[model samples]
Target: MVWVRLPVYFYKRNDTFYFSRSIPSDLQHRFNKRKIEVSLRTKSEAKAAKSAAALSDRLERYWDSLRMEMIYSRELGLKVLQDTKPCTTSEYSLSDALALYHRLKGGSKTKLFYDVSNRSIRYLEECLGHDNLTSIEKSDAGRFRDYLFARGMSSSSVKRVFSSVRAIINLAIREQGLVITNVFSGTFIPDDGAKQQRTPIPQDALKRVQMVCQTLDDEPRWLIALISDTGMRLSEACGLLTSDIHVDTVKPYIELIEHPWRRLKTASSSRQLPLVGASLWAAEKIIKEGNSFAFPKYCSEAKCNSNSASAALNKWLKPRVPAGCVIHSFRHSLRDRLRAIECPADIIDAIGGWTTEGVGHKYGDGHTLSVKYRWMEKIAPKVRELRSEETVT
Candidate 1:
């Protein structure tokens, strides 16, 4: 007599176990593909069996939920449509999807998230009217894209809107177990060309702007001066705590970290920026003020008001800086200045908190603050001196 292990709906491929199952006919319309396959990502038969069992249970529950929804809809006098035709209506509408998306993903997100998502839905309603999630077609998605272009929205902006719409619909589809295609998934967005380019401020214009910031010496000016050299995003600078600025320390750097009110844009965005030139001056001033938040007018316990900061700063900067060069242009200018000094690319990326490519770049604790300070010091010069040199030449 021999004992045999129970068989699981799993097979081995490339020495890894994969779970494969067939969709029931009733639920076949829900998924794009006929068969459901997932990598169990383990070599051990026991682990693969366990994973397959769990996944099978979840799929059965999901299919049962869909069946229940269909049964409930039939009870509500809703007509069941054929597989060839799109559903006339669904339990989830575009508005319902947006609400579900907000409830699930809006936690710890900035105001911009809500603003962008809401604006996208508003545009959809304007172009296509409010429709059920399942009723949205690929043609409708294309029309929405064209509508955005006609409204003078750039390709990048239009794509962002579509991205928000897609996420909203996708969440509703998964959560509600709806059988519907995401029409907004694959729309082609055109290139924005030079329209999207944020021109780097000219060196002369940059010097003059920095000088004016010093003269003004107000809260907004301090923020401008700090960002001009350090290349922090507006929100990142706005959300700083006074404690984040370390002027008296041996290195005199800004320890950029994520706060509840303000999150770093990327993992790379969280870095210790060495204070130099105008940035150091601004840091010293910010610390001397002894406020709880670095830029109290733009930041607080609840949120970092970056939109308000941008509006005010851009209006003030319009006359001071060259056209096409807004507050964000300082970040581009910083990269250019670093390049002029022949700073290493990786070091520059690290200093500016720009994501560096390649797996090797992730290996070690990046270039130390002292190493960054040395490179930044090369660009640290008096605006008056730099301006005078231009005159002499």
Candidate 2:
């Protein structure tokens, strides 16, 4: 079979082929450079041709997007095409879209959630303040990823921040009849799976911290010990009310429900966590005080309750725990321990407020507190047992 030759653009320098394409004359002024050149970094013609083809396609799409922007946004030095709807009041400001998006979608979320959404938008404003929403391009999204990385954000974090950015843009497009494509819709962040931000605290460090926790007579310490066994989220524990504790029942558990003061992360996050080991002791102490809120210092109406607890807990745990372990790691540890003990997956998920895959939706009334209590106690991550295992290992 004979290979049919097609048009190819490549230059060879120092025994390596590089893809080269001259910018369209009409769009050259829009770009900083007159032409685009990408190193194929291959001496073989076959390899160079394949690499250059992909690069050329990307450059073509980018140039076409630029040409479309010029026709739609700029008035002079272009044909008055009937299809081009010139940008005027049709394009909204990024700042305005941010407010509109938050007001519509962020009403019930926690302060920290809103902060992340707002901060992501603010970072965009810092880079391209008051830029038009419809005028945003793929290049802008790429720059945003670089900006987050330059500020030392992890790939996971950068991906999360971009997700918020994309949500804001997409929400405006879908709900409010905004016209632009979400440039952030399919933006990629490299190496997002390289390092996980949260990991289970090592058994040795957990045992040591549990030992030190027993000695301190402070609210943060109580909070730490309370979550040590139950694997409660820092926010859920902080925002608990006196009414949420159920130590009097046949199987005592912490009933996490939303209140006037604090909202839960998800409907599933509102769960009954069985109190065992250190958690039982902590609950008794919390009951002894008889305050309306479990931890009054952090649960005030005026404060961002979850953030207040996070700051306090992280500050206290930073020195005590091993490197890379934070307050959230307790939840990770509990999940790992439950899995290690061979507990049923659904029960473990229900105990942690995680969504069950296909369990209890049809017939049963869901796992009862008594059933959950047994499983929770079975894998409570108690200092004595876990520490002994660690020592033997």
Candidate 3:
């Protein structure tokens, strides 16, 4: 069969052919660039011609649709043309996406996950009237972003809101195989300013705080002491079951696991922590107390109230710690103390439940209690010594 030669927009550079076409001037506003070029990925003229012909036919049909839209826009006002736009509706609404996200991903997730998801969607709906997922335009995203910023939401917080919005919309798109752009995906969120880093508690201040906690020897003090040396997050400590504390074991440690009321932040967060100093003392106290939940005041079978614990703890700690330091500072201080003793980075990451890079890091159960006990022993003696000295003084 003779091949009839049709227009092939093939051009060769560096022995590779590409299909290139210029946008019609009227359609230029709809495109970011003047020309559309796609690599044919072939050096052979026949292959290049075949690919180029197919590409040209596709682009022609697409451009013809655009031309038809413009014709309708001029005849019937832009609003009427927009109202008739095909594929403008989505199978899922923004609220539906949230429901789907929660339904699929909410297992073992705390109330915070649902609360944040709901709040993020509410913020969007408040700004843009709960538009369908597909109907969310780039301009709507921009407007929603501005609305958040106008309400004194920090740039990072604004990004988080957009993140939830994007994830919800994206899940709907993927699960339903919908061909639609997530307008919230790449919207620019301007930085308000440099975020204030949480200052690590000074060694002296930490010792003094531990001393005070020991003197008080109450449930709240136990919470403080538990986190002071263990580097476990406040939520992690607050959510612990009494059984998680293994002081009776040969080498004392806390089995950090996800509870119904609380979830570990990452898979790495689920590891054993060798208790020492204030943390060990606190564990012993907790076991003697004999409650099902370690911090029953904050954690329940229904939910872990880490936020409430944070507020009370931070307030008590405010006058004791330096400006900018909070309960989280103990986690930071633990890292610094470990580093000061020249602890290996991997050991520090293991102790702190911090995520480390590399596939090999994920291979097995991380550092054994005995192995972690050794590294923990090195930095914990100072705080323990302070407890003794303060009691005597």
Query: Highest TM-score, which number?
Result: 3
Q: Is candidate 1 or 3 superior in TM-score?
A: 3
Record all residue pairs in model 2 with backbone atoms less than 3 Å apart, i.e. clashing: none
In candidate 1, what are the lDDT values of residues 158-249, reduced to their tens digit? 88899988899888888877878888898888887626679898877877777777777899989998998898899899999999999897
Q: Is candidate 2 or candidate 3 better by TM-score?
A: 3
Counted clashes in each candidate structure: 0, 0, 0
Mind giving the per-residue lDDT tens digits that candidate 2 earns over 256-375?
A: 887767777776788778998778777877998899888998887655377767887889888877788889999999999889889888888788988776644535667888888888
Per-model CA lDDT versus the true structure: 0.83, 0.75, 0.82
- Alpha-carbon TM-score of each model against the true structure: 0.73, 0.70, 0.75
Of 2 and 3, the candidate ranking higher by lDDT: 3
Candidate with the larger lDDT of 1 and 2: 1
Model 3 compared with the native: what TM-score?
0.75
Residue 255 miss distance in model 2 (angstroms): 1.2
Best-to-worst order by TM-score is 3, 1, 2
